[model samples]
Target: MTPARFAGVLSAAVTLGVAAACSDGGSPVDPGGCAADLTTGIAAYDLDGLDVHAVLPTSTSSCIVANADSHFVAVDPSAQPSGRLFVFLPGSAARARNYRKIAFAAARAGYPAIVLTYVNDLPVGVRCAFGTGDCYEEVRREIITGVDASSRLTVGPDDAIEGRLVHLLTAMESLDPGSGWSTFHDGASPRWDRISVAGHSQGGGHSLFLSRETTVFRATAYSSAGDLEPLSATPVPWLDGSWATPAERIGGFISEDDEVVSPSGAIAAWTRIGLDDFGGPVSVDDTAAPWAGARMLTTRAPPRNAGAVFTPHHGVTVVDGLTPLELDGAPTFGPVWAALSFPGS
Candidate 1:
């Protein structure tokens, strides 16, 4: 699809909003004091050197769907960017707005970041009856199906999601020269060579697919298991051991007590990719030769959210306002942040 058409579909599907809480004149460090006041028990990180900007759809597109509001650009205004792009994909039934804190933290740590939203197929107001019933399973199937559809539409030549994303990146690059999104590339195309992708839940599964299609320096999936082959073909590297890139660059984060995607799936993915189980919070197997970059992390403890007490451990990675219990000196979100900021860490 043409960029214009893709933008129209996205704009028609979702509304956009500036993240006022992160912007406005305030201390660049923790702009709205969001990081400092996180009740999720994850340690607060500083965003002192960065500026968060709301993106608007480019003027040419009739639909105002895929702009900075629905997406965000986090950059440091003080210095030249390293030309690296860190893209974060939100989970099923979740929007990019929910991950602003993580994006901001990435930018603070010096990685230009973008938070993306895809189709959410989960029915509204339906809660996963974790362990009590099969409601969660039904919802999960729908979510996986939705993810497959969205991926097929976006990643390939049809370009529903991927096209709109490139269009927005191009626009943002032009809107702010020498800073923000612009620092990553000229208006023509992104510095694809320096890109890394990360996602949570359904988005995590999508990230795995995207890494297979596009060569990224690093890819990380959180609270997600690989989809069934019939639903979405497993990435070639994961199955045939013929990685498109080094296996060391791919990682997975699984919450030990996750009630959403099976923890076994995450473990399986890690083991399939040649990582060994160290029986610890984090595991690494740099000696795996071709797959030297593979790593896996299990959440030190179960996750909790103030809003939903019963639904524990499902979305500990990207649930907005949810803090993770620190394990091995890092919170649930820590592994993801590290993957984006310091690839191979």
Candidate 2:
């Protein structure tokens, strides 16, 4: 876009407030080796035929209050569009760049993908540990919609997760109009029905809640669904709250030996959400693609970093650092990701 035209869009964004702070023109990056993509517990994904970019959101815009980092965008140069956008969110305090492998896999599966940067400094469970079940749901509502429904965090409409997504998608439309990002946008809001949502850990919880709030194309959680209620065998009972996505339209993946959230609690949450209607949680290690048509999927696969002292069970499913590697350097859990979010590919 011309500089003057870009300025006009920025002006419009500022006027809109909540939708402000979309990205500047995205900058191409070497996917195989971005320094920040790899850290103490994060991994960098190598590119196959995908173009990876780091697009900085405008700090002047309202949508970037709690955090002002770049969002990661991935696209396969040679794949046919799948008529779907794969949206990935990172865990608490995790950087967006750390999720390139998951996003790259999505791109290869024919869906353009993005790893968003948002206000994830405060984990939901940590902030709402002592409250009732509604506290968990309402905190998430505040985070995603800026509804001020909870007191855990002060997220405004502009700094809410939805606002950040709207901003980034708007950025893609303005800076890369020919890239087809507009297909996921309807008017000023995201066409959530055409978007598939998934994430790791805390992001996974957010994914579940967002799916609950809207009829997303699909909802998949990796290594998380919801936090367990303290001193209880279940997650905070909020699935029965106002809902949109059905249990059948949702899928989840996790390491069977996760150390963060109790496996039984996760299973309890899934069962209560009605995932048992599709089928019980199936192990990906013994089963293949369809996984017996199950919506709740689990794996006993050991982490690659198991020998490095102790494995971080929570990172085994999708994080680059702990997830095992295949012979070709692709993520060991690559196929599982596609399975969890299939039909979008």
Q: TM-scores across all candidates?
A: 0.62, 0.83
Q: Write the per-residue lDDT of candidate 2 for residues 194-308, one digit (tens) a residue.
A: 8888888889888898887789988888888676777875777676565698777788888889888777778877777788898878887887777777988888888876765
**How many clashing residue pairs are found in candidate 2?**
0
**Which candidate number would show the highest TM-score if scored against the true structure?**
2
Give me the candidate number with maximum lDDT. 2
In model 2, pairs of residues that clash are: none
**Global CA lDDT computed for model 1:** 0.49
lDDT of 1 at 311: 45
> Candidate 2 at 272: error in angstroms?
1.3
lDDT of 1 by residue, 1-345 (tens): 346634543442232211123211211212111111111111112255565544433321222222223456666666445556778877756777777767765665556778754444442113332222233333333332222222112212112244335545654443434545544443323444476777777677656655655566677777765442322323213333444645566777766777766676567665665545333235322122222233676664545564574445666665655646455523446545565334432
Worst 10 residues of 2 by lDDT: 30-39
lDDT of each: 0.49, 0.72
